[model samples]
Target: MGHGTRDKILIAAATMLGEDPTAKLSVRAVAARAGVSTGSLRHFFPTQRELIDTVVAGMYTVDLPDDPMQDTASPPAERLVACLQLLLAQVGTGESARGYWRALHAAYVASPPSDDAVHAFLAHERLAVHYVERWLVRLRDEGALAPGEPGHHARFLLTVVNGLLTERALPGDLTRLEFEARTLMTAASAVLRPASSDRP
Candidate 1:
């Protein structure tokens, strides 16, 4: 089978899992979704376990930010908030976020995808924390952050972000969501900033 054929199956499976943690991704279902034969899918992924594992690994693969990661020369607070917003953006928000949700719902309601009942959705949380940690490294390099564990700072930032995403899962005023997000980012920056103005 063509390598592209194999990749298509994996991509189809991964997209299904991201949209619905409970998605049914049988070999036949995935093959149909990928526009390939069951034989082809089996050729790439010998068993359901292999297929599900590949999809779980891909659960965190997404375009988290439109902007380049290296562009962190802006003010520490601004950069910090931007990083958080990137994560929230992935979680969805307001009108733009709704489009993604609608599509995900539509995909779930109409699909050719599931395997094991296991959902590796938490990989998204881990990915978000890593993204935040990268921002912290940028700050530390610029002498803007106080010495401490980057993971600690990352967890704190992700906590607020995860809460924001959780709240967003339900119906709410967009303005309220934006306000709460801002408040969280501000508090996170304050806690992470150095006490003195001196660089080092």
Candidate 2:
């Protein structure tokens, strides 16, 4: 089928899956939702696995900043904070995005060991790490950070962020953004602090 038709089918499938994680995704259901014919859906995704795979892949695809740490005009710390905020914004509690995330997590947990899940998890983790690395690199280049391994600091930051994401996913009183922001600031300070009081 044409690109438009295929895209429509994917959208329909994603919407349905978001609504009900346990919903059986079939060609007929997706086609009906998309207002397209079964033949068209088949032309795009010949099998259920293919369609599901595509949706899974799309979930991790995010719009990353071209230069997440550099705005040249802004302070490096400000730029870094903005970049981090952008990442956090993706974890929406809204119905559509939240439902999609919930469904994705359920599928990941239920599926058997597979390369697809492994690859997706690695890719997302790398992206988070790379974002942190960029911020560290920029800060170091600008002489804002103390001497250290930027990559190591980046990995550490990513670990912290991942933990925060996990905590946010669970049912509880959501941590206020102000608290999160302050916590991040404190962590960043600790990561960049100078070694000794006597050091000039």
Candidate 3:
């Protein structure tokens, strides 16, 4: 029963995260979602940070439905661009993208965040980095990518996506899509230098 209750709490937290990436997993919100008392939720996860860390950490193991990394037949750049698109898809565009950035600013930039808030933000950031690193690692192992730190390459790619995500929230014309596609392609190709070659 103890384990079951813990699982319920975790499932509820994860569900809330899935529903809204910005969902503040307050003890009351999570407990109510899980159909458990606040005390029960606290017994399983003593703090909001712990609950968030556990949920986001689990995301590292969850495979995306159509992971581009699995398409070995595709060129490295194509696979990587597809992967970045997956990230973009999650954030969406226009109002949806605005909401994501809004939540981020409200939580981290509007005022000083508590330690727990900072931890939650970092947890989600790490999960994004982890997914990108996995793809880079696979390309490296297959000799498709130049010898370099996968984490560095992952951050580089994520930096590109991050900029694009922010741009999506701002007003732009139809050509924005064209520019975005070109930018993603360039970023992907830039990082996918062949193993046999040296980057200038």
List TM-scores for all candidates, in order. 0.68, 0.56, 0.93
Candidate 3 ranges with C-alpha deviation above 4 Å: 194-200
Model 3 Cα lDDT, one tens digit per residue, 97-195? 999899889888999988888788788888989999999888888777755788888899999999999999999977997899899998877778753
> On a 0 to 100 scale, what is the lDDT of residue 84 in model 1?
74
Q: Which sections of candidate 1 miss by over 4 Å?
A: 17-26, 47-49, 52-65, 94-119
Better of 1 and 3 by TM-score: 3
In model 2, what lDDT does residue 158 have? 69
What tens-digit string does per-residue lDDT give for candidate 2 at 114-157? Answer: 55445544544555676677678777876776567888888776
lDDT score for residue 68 of model 2: 55
For TM-score, the strongest prediction is 3
lDDT value, candidate 2, whole model: 0.66
- Candidates in order have lDDT scores of 0.68, 0.66, 0.88
lDDT of 3: 0.88
What is the Cα-based TM-score of model 1?
A: 0.68
> In model 2, how large is the Cα lDDT of residue 160?
62
Which candidate would rank higher by lDDT, 1 or 2? 1
